[model samples]
Target: MGDSRPVYQRIADDLRQQIDEGVLAVGSRIPSRSELKRTYAASDQTVDRAVRVLKAAGYAEGQFGRGVFVTDRSPVGSLLRTGEAVDSPFAARLLAGSSAAPPLLWEATSTATGAPPRIAERLGIGAGDRVMCTRYEYLADRRPLQLATSWEPLALTEGTEVVFPERGPYARRGVRERFAAIGLPVVKATELVGSRSATSTESQALGCSPGQCVTVIERTHHTADGQVVETSDIVLRADRWRLEYHIAFPG
Candidate 1:
């Protein structure tokens, strides 16, 4: 029973349950520390500890002066699944900081995982091979925007810690810059776009309503030599993002 757990653990568990039950949907503000202390009849330390636990577990996040709030629960794939490839040009233009695009915030993380079957096939490697994975979550004006994960062969990344770099490549030389340093320069990319419903875990991350649709963008990058060096899958929130593409015609 929750009662047997530590008071802080119990409080965290209760909050987690609330989130799972939709009592605290995405963007919902949580009680202040003092309020939580009073409600739980616990000390400030206990309440603070509970909040920290929740945050560490990715259930909640703190906003300066605004207190804590529930995280978005939308899945990352909702934004790219529309059978619409027409927006690729527009998205590319936006990535290029073209005149018509708005500014955005992008965060990236690199990880190492035992290659899953799907990823292995994409990289022409065996399943369970060690692989370096880079995840990117892009936001526009602090809203849930787009999600992407890129995978590379671990052998190719030896001597370079692409994943968990001290300062993310995006923060330094940018994604292209970092890859270039490792001799994996990207020359061209092919994409496949589709849609699907959000998984429970993805729904929690994207802060979307249950059963909401999502977009998925799968991309494979090739070097100038035509070697498939990296593969990325990007998921996005459908409502929060728009896809735009440019059409070119020649006489």
Candidate 2:
């Protein structure tokens, strides 16, 4: 049967297969516009459409004054989720067991602000409630790899040493440890994972192409009494990282 698919689509599929088979290795330049036009007997518009499809699907990228090229799809690293994540900084948990690269860096800025509706809901507080919000950018193998924003209700830590997550004597301590010092021992946690196209802000911040796929994690930590302690939203490029989870089953 003839391919009912469009010419541009068939072209994209063939290129994708070549990429998968390593015939077109990462960093290898794809055929130029004129070359593809001649080879496929395709119009300039059809060839352009095929290239756009490759870029959008993350199969290729274009360089200034250069033709499109296959992109490296290997993950930069993985985020390890284990029992220790409750007490470890998010950046520290990334590839801690693997020799990813020396010197992981986490840049963070915390501000006292009112929670947005979505964040408020995750933290189980009213919209616009006061919370200490911290934004983080993590570099793995010295590449901007992940971004996260955390919201902690001020009601639970007002005037306390841990009020500012990135400041004070308890700064940088994980929620379970820091909250335990103040009488809230976190006992439960949950995460909802999903994926969608990266937003413009995310694309610029992470240095990836626009419309790339990203994994979104909505995570919450709860105290023994069932009160939520902290919640966070995390984003990472789908082509550059994998999420690994570890669960301990009590014998």
For this target, which candidate reaches the highest lDDT against the unseen true structure? 2
Q: Summarize candidate 2's per-residue lDDT along 129-239 as a digit string, tens digits.
A: 999998998775667778998899999999899888878888888888789889898898888989998898998888677788898988899987789999988898887
Local distance difference test scores for all models: 0.66, 0.84
Clashes of each: 25, 0
- Poorly placed runs, candidate 1 (over 4 Å): 1-103, 161-175, 249-251
Worst 10 residues of 1 by lDDT: 74-83
| Residue 115 error, candidate 2, Å | 1.3
lDDT of 1 by residue, 50-164 (tens): 9877765556777888888887543222122222442231143233432223555677676788889998888788999988787776665565466777787777765674544
Query: How do all models score by TM-score?
Result: 0.54, 0.91
